[model samples]
Target: MTTTTELSELTGDYVLDSAHTRIGFVAGAAMVTKVRGQFDEFEGSAHLDGDDPSQSSAQLTIQAKSIQTRNQRRDDHLRSKVFLDVDNRPTISFISIGVEQVDETNFKGTGDLTIRGVTKQVTVDFELTGTENDPQGRFRVGFHGKATINRKDWGVSWGRGLVSEKVTLEFDVAAIRQP
Candidate 1:
């Protein structure tokens, strides 16, 4: 397994800290309102080898029902039929096929992101927030990743005029190194 390290540092496996991580999605409804929500139970892992950024990989699993918003009614509607059908897909996931260093704290990686039973290639923009050991000596690392895609491309165009074609997905998943 891989643990946390520097961009120019060594590589290993790190287990995601579900308690400290969040994966959010925001989509525009018409030109007046926006719909926002998040997946509740998500786990992510990254395998980064200092020698080969190309060899690095990432994977994330997000529970659908965890979706939420400022308004409860709207959130319910989104989870119902107008948007994500949690019963059908249940879980949204992203499995990385490749990763490349854009610069320090930045990465441009290509992966297959699945939402609402639709999978498409998406280039993720990620930033690492360094690593630290807890009082128990367990190493934890922070990461923030983002990407945007056309809802129509993935058969997810449920709300046309009410929702924007472009959906922005962001992730703030923190993982710990388990020795």
Candidate 2:
């Protein structure tokens, strides 16, 4: 089925449907190959304003220890002090400072992203895929977003030669309106 939604009609508080959402990343390795990974645990919420998109906001927190690359050894290394240092810094978070609607289905979210112990401003362009009512009678909105960042800025500078400094993050999110 086809669905369309206007930003003015989406004003509400929503909770991310983590079961259907994905937060993943890609980084070049050895200047030749690319490594992909994802965080398995996260929670987020968003407040959208129909009248003024700039008033909308979102926040997300991800468990650093939950990083998965499909390789046990590599994943373990990433959780070590050389990378995420999950033991000392267990959570990565983002809080949106502002949002701008580019069009009916596109938006730009600017925010501060905290990783390890450092926080940096980043912007993610998001596309509102659609909105639908599930069989369970819940209204859901779906979005896809992406942003690129330098991992070194976040103090994750261990893999100088083995891994690329630039990391691209992707978000596939589905949120349900709060009652």
Looking at model 2, the pairs that clash are: none
Q: lDDT for each of the candidates? A: 0.78, 0.92
Residue by residue across 1-179, what tens digits does model 1's lDDT show?
A: 24344554436788788888888888887689777777777787888766778898888888877787777887687677557787777888889988888876677879998878888899988887667777788766777888888988867667668789988988887777757
lDDT for model 1, on a 0 to 1 scale? 0.78
Residue-level lDDT for 174 in candidate 1 = 75
List TM-score per model, in order: 0.88, 0.97
Question: lDDT of model 1 at residue 67?
Answer: 81
Q: What is the RMSD, in Å, between candidate 2 and the native fold over all Cα?
A: 1.0
Find the candidate with the highest TM-score and give its number.
Answer: 2
The list of candidate 1 runs beyond 4 A from truth reads: 1-10
**For model 2, how does the per-residue alpha-carbon lDDT over 7-77 read when each residue is reduced to its tens digit?**
67778999999999999999999999999999999999999887898999999999999999999999999
